[model samples]
Every structure is written in C-alpha cells, then in structure tokens.
Target: MFLLIRISQQLINGLSIGSIYALIAIGYSLIYSILMFSNFAHSSFLLMGAYTGFYILILLSSSFPLSLLIAMLGSGILAVLIEKIAYKPIRDRGNPTLYFIIASMGISIFFENFIICTIGPRFRSYPRIMQTTFVELGKLNISVMDIYAAVVAIAFLLMLSYLIEKTKVGIAIRAASFDLEVVGLMGVNTNMLISIVFLIAGILAGLAGEFLGVKYTVYPQLGYITNKAYIAAVFGGLGNLKGAVLGSILLGLLEALITGFLSSAMRDIFVFCLLILVLLIKPSGLMGIQKQDKV
Candidate 1:
C-alpha cells in the first residue's frame, strides 16, 4: 500500500513538471515548424518572462494574475521585436540554416551575460503567492501549486489547439508550415504569420517561466531548464505538437520515478542516456515523419 502511494505521488509530481515542460517544448516546436530552425534565443525570451514576472510580483505585492499577463505580453512583444530586428533580415537575405542557428546562439548568450552584468547574477525567490496547503487524497498528498500549474498549462495548450485547428490564421500557419514560399506566393503575409508564431511561442514560454520561477528561484540561468524542454521536443519529434507534449510528459515521469526510486544525482545522466538511445535507435523520433529532399 505504501509503495502504491509512493508511485502515485511520483506520477502526480511527474505530470505537474511535465506540463511545464510541455509548455516550453510546444513553443519551441511551433517555432521550428514554421521556421525550420531552432531558436536558441528562446531561452532569452524565457529569461525575459521570468524577470518580468519576478519584478511584477515584487513591486505589485503578488498580484499573480496581473503579473502573469504582463509577463506574457512583454515576452510576446519582445519576441516579435527580435523576429523583426534580428531574424527577419536573415530570412530576407535567404541565408543558410546555420546562420539562423548561430544568430540564435549569439542572442541567447547576449541575454544571459547582459542579465548577469546588469542584474548582478543573483537568484531571487518568488514571494509566497500560492498557498502551501496540500490536498490529501487517500494516502497521497498533492500540492495545490502543482495542480494550479497543471491546470493553467492545460488551459493554454487547449487554447493554442483551438487557434491552430479552428481559426483561419491557423489555416495559414498550417499551410505555411508545409511550404512557406508557396504560402507567401499565394498572397499570405508570410512575415506577419511568422510574427504571430513568435508571439504565441513567446507567450507560452513566458507562462512557463513564471511557473518555473514560482516553483524554484528566478535567476538568469533559469532559462537553462529549457534545455530539457528542447531535449523533450527532440525526443518526441520536432515540429509535432502532440509529440512534444508526450515526450515532455514521459521525460518528466522518468525523472520523477528516477529521483523517487534512485538518486536525484543520476536523473540527468539517465535523461541524456535516454536521448542518446533514442537518437541511435530512432533518429526521426517517436512521431516525427521523415522528410525527403528533392534533388
């Protein structure tokens, strides 16, 4: 009975963390789907959201909903600006994928160092906004914050699904994902569509960032957690939303079980090893479809 309870607890914990990872991975996968490049600068957007939420909570006395909105809006605007100022020019020039990757790396590094230099590299704890109360079910105790995080994450993801599957803009985005050039030629505003994608991605990342800050501490390096999200994106299948979510949940579950049953120290090692195994065995990932290049 005790063992069963323990397993259930870990499953709940895993689902909570996995929801957060799903938020980040979904954003990353969305950008990859449209742009065909990994925006490593996504970490910068996450950092922006974290800091924005932190400052809002500090100054506004823990107005949680307001802080969440402002952080998401701020990050979304920043994403659009970055897309216009940095990435748009590169896309206009028809540069190689390597260039976009390098540029994203540079942007991520710049944000990290800029925050370190200006914000003093200090970690800030979020004020106690959430109740510390736990809801007990049977012999298992579940955290209220975990429930909150999971609910919020699911709500946003559902909204995103509605936008993508039910809206006209979503239709264009889907078309653009297939062949951006063709969509542009068909009179779609490719640039605007791309900007919308960035905005949505940034908004989701910001929400993830706020949750992460509340769960842990807010620091410039907080964005490093997105690395795991990236791995999850790849593990499930890049450019596949369902795949990203599934991969994140599985990864979170694996981590939780490992930490619960074994040592926390071995969790990361096992994660990387799993990644290696996946790459070796199925490079296309669980749900990714192989694409062929035309000669």
Candidate 2:
C-alpha cells in the first residue's frame, strides 16, 4: 500500500509538470507549423514572461491574476514586435530558412545576455502567493499547487484547442500550415495571420513562465527548461499540437517515475536516450506524417 501511494504521488507530480511542458511545447509547435522553422527565440519570450511576472508579483503584492494577464500581454506584444522587426524583413527578402533560424538564435542569445547583464544572474523566488498546502485523498497526499497547475494548464490548452479548431482564424492557420504561399494567394492577410500565431505562442509561453516562476525560482536560465519542451515537441511530432501534449505528458511521467525509483541523475540521461531511440526508430515522430520531397 505504501509503495502504491508513492507511485500514485509520482504520477500526479508527473502530470503536473507535464502539463507545463505541454503549454510550452504547444506554443513551439504552433510557430513551427506556420513558419516551418524552430523559433529558438521562443525561449526568450518565456524568460521575459517569467521576469515580468516576477516583478509584477513583487511590486503588486502577489496579485496573481493581474500578473498573469500582464505577463501574457507583454510577451505577446514582444513577439509581435520581434516578428515585425526581425522575421518580417527576412520573410520579405525571401531568404532561405537558415536565415530565419540564425536570426532566432541571435535574438535568443541577445535576450539571455540582456537579462544576465541587467538582472545580475541571481535567482529570485516569487513571493508566496499560494500556500504550501497538500490535499489528502485515500492515503495519498497531493500538493495543492500541483493540482492547481494541472488544472490551469488544461484550461489554457482547451481554450487554445477551441480557438484553433473552431474559429475562422484557425481554419486559415490550418490552411497556412499546409501551404503558406497558397494561403496568401487565397486573400488571407498572411502577415496578420503570422502575427496572430506569434502572439498566441508568446501568450502561452508567458503563462507557462509564470507557472514555472511560481513553482521554482525565477532566473535568466529559467528559459532553459524549454529545452525539455522542445524535446517533447519533437518526440510527439513537431507541428502537431496533440502530439506535443502527449509527448510532454509521457516525458513528465517517465522523469517522475525514474526520479522516484532510481536517482535524479539518471532522469535527464533517460530523457535524452529516449529522444535518441525515437529518432532512430521513428524519425517522423509518433504522430507525425512523412512528407515527400518535391522534385
């Protein structure tokens, strides 16, 4: 019975963290779907969101909802600015995809360094907004924060799903994902659509950042967590939102179980090994469809 309880606890913990990963991976996948390039700068948006929320909480006395909204809005505006200032020029010039990738890397590096230089590279904890409390259920003790995180993550994901699957903009986004050039020719404002995609992606990343900041310390390096999310995105299939969520949950569960039973040291090793195994066995990812090269 004790062992069962331990296992259940780890499972719940895994789900909570996995839900966070899903948030980040979904945003990453959304941008990839429309742009056909990995936005390494996405991590910077996460960093920006974290810092923004941290400052808001510190200054505003733990107004969680206000901080969340402001962080999301700030990050969304930053994303739009990035698109217009950097990516749009590249897009207009009809440069190769490599240029976009390099530009994103540059932007990411700039943000990281900018934060380190200005913020002094020290970790800061968020003020206690939610109590460190636990809920007991059937001999299993679960963290309230964990439960809250999972619930919030699911709620945001559902809203995203509804926006994508039900709205007209979503239909256009789906069409753009298939063939961006064709969509532009079809009278959709491709620029506006792309901006909206970036905005949504940034907003989600910001929310994830706030959750992470509350769960752990806020630091410039906090964005590094997005690496795992990137792996989850690839593991589930890049550009596939459903696959991203599945991959994130599975990865979270694997990490939690491994940490509980084995050692924390083995957790990341196992994750990378799993990534290697997936790439070797199924390069197209578990849910990704293989595409043929145009001759």
Candidate 3:
C-alpha cells in the first residue's frame, strides 16, 4: 500500500513536471521543424515569462489568469523579437550552427544574470492569487494546484495538437515540418510562418514558466530547472514533438519516483544516469527516429 501510494504520488508529480518540459520541447521542436536548430534561447524566454508575470502582477495588481495572459503575450512578443534580431540573419549561413548555438547560450546567460539583477538572487513566489489549494482523496493527498497545472498543460497540449492537425495554420506547420524549403518554394510566406512559430513557442514557454512559478516559486535563475526537460527533448528527438513530450513525461515520472524512494539529492543524478543508459541503448533516443542528415 505504501509503495503503491508512493508510486501514485510520483506518477502525478512526474506527469506534471513532464508536461511542463513537454511545453519547452514543443518550443524547441516547432523551431526545429521550421528553421532547424533555432531553439536554444527557449529556456531564457521561460524566465522572461515568469519575470513578466512577476512584474505585471506587481504593477497592475492583476489576478492570476490575467497576469498569466499578460506574461504569455509578453513572452510571445519577446520570442518574436529574439527571432528577428538574434536569429534571423544568422540562419542558414555557413557557420549558422556554431554562431546560433553560442548566441543562444549568450541569451541564456544574459537572462540568468538579468533575472538576478531584476529580482535579486532569492526565490520569490507569485502573488497569493496564484496559490493552490489542497484536497484529500481517500488517503491520497491531492492539491488543487497540481490538478490545475496538469489540466492547463494538458489543455494546451490538446490545443497545440489541434492547431497542428486541423486548421490552415496547422496544415502549414505540418507541411513546413516535413519539407520547409519546398513549402517555402511553394509560396507559403515561410518567413511569416516561422515568425508565428516562434511566437507560439514563446507562449508555450511562458505558460510553462507560469506553471513553474505558481506551483513552485519564482527565482531569478529559474530557467536552470528546465535543464532536465532539455535532456528529455534531446532524448526524445530534437525535432519530434511527440517524442519530446513522451520522453519528458517518462523522465518526470522517473525523477519523482527516485525522489520519493530515495532522497532529493539523488534524484538529479539518478535521472541523468537513467538518461545516459537510455541513450546508450537506444542511441537516437527512444523516439529520435527522424535522423539528422549529414552534409
């Protein structure tokens, strides 16, 4: 009974965290599908989302939902800005990979420090409006926040899936996903689509940031936490949204179980060990079957 309870709790935690990672993975995959490897600044955008909400709440005294909307929109705008200024020119150049990756790292570093400068070097919680409630379920303890986070993330996932599968924009993203150059040649206004994809990616990261900030706490260096999700993204396949989400959920569950069974300190190491093992066995990731091409 104890083990079962432990597993249930861990599973819930994992799903929650994994879903957040999946959000980031979506950001990575969307850009990857379009521009191929233009997603390194994603984590920084998440930080920006949290900070965006932090200040919007302080400045306007807004409610949680409203604050979140502002944050997501703010971050989405920033995502577009980053693409235009930081990534647009460097894309597809001879040294695009090296230059862009470094630029992304620079963005990440700048945000990490910028958060420190703006919010100070301590952990901060969102406004009380974002606080979650707890509920009891037949000896199984559940929190309203957990349910809310899971539901919102899942809903976003569904919306994203629908967007990719149903609408005209979905058709474009799908087409671009398969063969961006050809789609562009077919007169799809590929640049506009790419910009929209970055904006969408930003919104997703902003939502994930809100999830992290409200459920946990907002810190200046919060993007560091999403590193595990980065690993999951790579493990699942860089350009594969389904793979990234699946891997994130799996890793989230695994980490939660480790934390429950052992100690928190061991959870990170344990997860990486498992990840390495997975890579060793599966190589291209459990779902990285798309296969990178060689020049």
Alpha-carbon TM-score of each model against the true structure: 0.97, 0.97, 0.93
Comparing 2 and 3 on lDDT, the stronger one: 2
TM-score of 1: 0.97
Q: What is residue 200's positional error in candidate 3, in angstroms?
A: 1.0
- Give the 10-residue window scoring lowest on summed lDDT in candidate 1: 285-294
Question: What residue runs in model 2 are displaced by over 4 Å at the alpha carbon?
Answer: none
Give per-residue CA lDDT, model 1, range 86-200, as digits (tens).
9999999999989889999999999999999998798899888664778999888888888898999999999999999999999999888888999999999999999999999
lDDT of 3 by residue, 138-184 (tens): 66767787788788888988999999889999899989988888898
Candidate no. 3 TM-score: 0.93
Q: What is the lDDT of candidate 2?
A: 0.90
Q: Lowest-scoring 10 consecutive residues by lDDT in candidate 3?
A: 129-138
* Cα displacement (Å) at residue 82, model 1: 1.1
Candidate number that wins on lDDT, 1 or 2: 1
Q: What TM-score would you give candidate 2 relative to the actual structure?
A: 0.97
lDDT values for all models:
0.91, 0.90, 0.82
Worst 10 residues of 2 by lDDT: 285-294
In candidate 3 the C-alpha lDDT for residue 129 amounts to 57
